[model samples]
Target: MRVALMITCFNDALFPDTGKAVLTVLRRLGVEVDFPAAQACCAQPMVNTGYLDEAVPVVRNFVRAFEGYDAIVAPSGSCAGSIRHQHGLVARRSGDAGLATAVARLAPRSYEFSEFLVDVLGVEDVGASFPHRVTFHPTCHSLRMLGVGDRPQRLLRKVHGLQLVDLPAAGECCGFGGTFAVKNADTSIAMGADKARRVLETGAEVLVAGDNSCLMHIGGILSRQRAGVRVMHLAEVLASHEGAA
Candidate 1:
């Protein structure tokens, strides 16, 4: 199967390690993944920020870059959800039937990392070993947009020496809704504090979430409080092995 990695722009700029970790985990699974140099932002920022027209070229670039891949795997549920749910809207708004058709064809083929692992690859354990007490925060897009319920948790359960703790109100949004954090700074910080409190309540060494955007927001709060808690992307945790620096 031809699989491509749609490393979203946020990851590319801020959390390049997450993208590398995704490659690590997929390669370890014997999945020969392709990284299309032509790939760019999934246009979620424009669409979510009320700039659908500006998003057309980005969406166009997205479908073109990942057109022929049998599956496009994105490490982010936010970007994957944008591709699956929002791309069609942008296409239709452009009044381009061809674009709409292209989006419909490619969107369904796009899968979030956990969805690809648990649903497509059908493997819970990817031979990962992380001896850490970790608590997972289900990002909003992953939980609500993609309906990736328990799939991430199921995979976490199988990691060797990993203790998966239940985060209080795991479904609540961390207020890192992309631009939402920037536009509504006060409310965003309040919500992030609440989420950070929950993470601390778990008393876990690390806070894990599929989307690094959310992790960054909460991690900032944790760092300011000197919480001494590390934030890691889910892919980073999964890519971890028994012995490697």
Candidate 2:
């Protein structure tokens, strides 16, 4: 299948290697993946921040940019969730029937990384090796919104030499809801601290998550506390070899 990588705005700027890792893994698995440079934000930020009116153009641009792919895969659950769940709302909020129709035609085809790997590609072992003790964090959108379930864990378990550990209360939110952190700093930090504590308790060298935004949120607390846990994207872990992660 011809797939396009919807590198979310957050990933494009902050976690570039995450995108590269996704590309590497997909290509290695013999999937034709491409990135439409014209693609930008999925408008998740604006919509999540109570700006549906402002998110209309962004939603439009997202649909327009990644228009022709058979599948649009994003390494981020939050962004993929935005496209699947919010685009219709934004189109309706804008009172654009044409846009709404276009979105309905496209949104279902967009999948998060784990969803694509498990549900679409139908393969868990991508011939990857990462000999490290690792724990995974199920981000809010992937867990609650997209309902990705244990697809990520299923894939991670098949990786050679990787010890997958259970995260304490793995379903809990990391509290990095885009603007939620900024609007409620104390609560965000508290939530992040709790997550970091749980991650440290796993005694894993790496703390992995489907969304970099959550990793970024929890990583900060882990870093400040000198938790000695490396934060990584699931794609990075899947793409890791003896050379790079």
Per-residue accuracy of model 2 over 122-227 as CA lDDT, tens digit each: 9899888999999999999998889999999999999988999999998888888989999999999999999999998889999999999999999999999987
List where candidate 1 sits over 4 angstroms from the true fold.
Answer: 243-245
TM-score of each: 0.98, 0.97
lDDT by residue (41-159, candidate 1, tens digit) is: 99999999899999999999998899999999999999999999999999999999999999999999999999999999999999899999999999998888999999999999999
Regions more than 4 Å wrong, model 2: 243-245
Highest TM-score, which number? 1
- TM-score between model 1 and native: 0.98
lDDT of candidate 2 vs native?
A: 0.91
lDDT of 2 at 245: 52
Pairs in steric clash, model 1: none
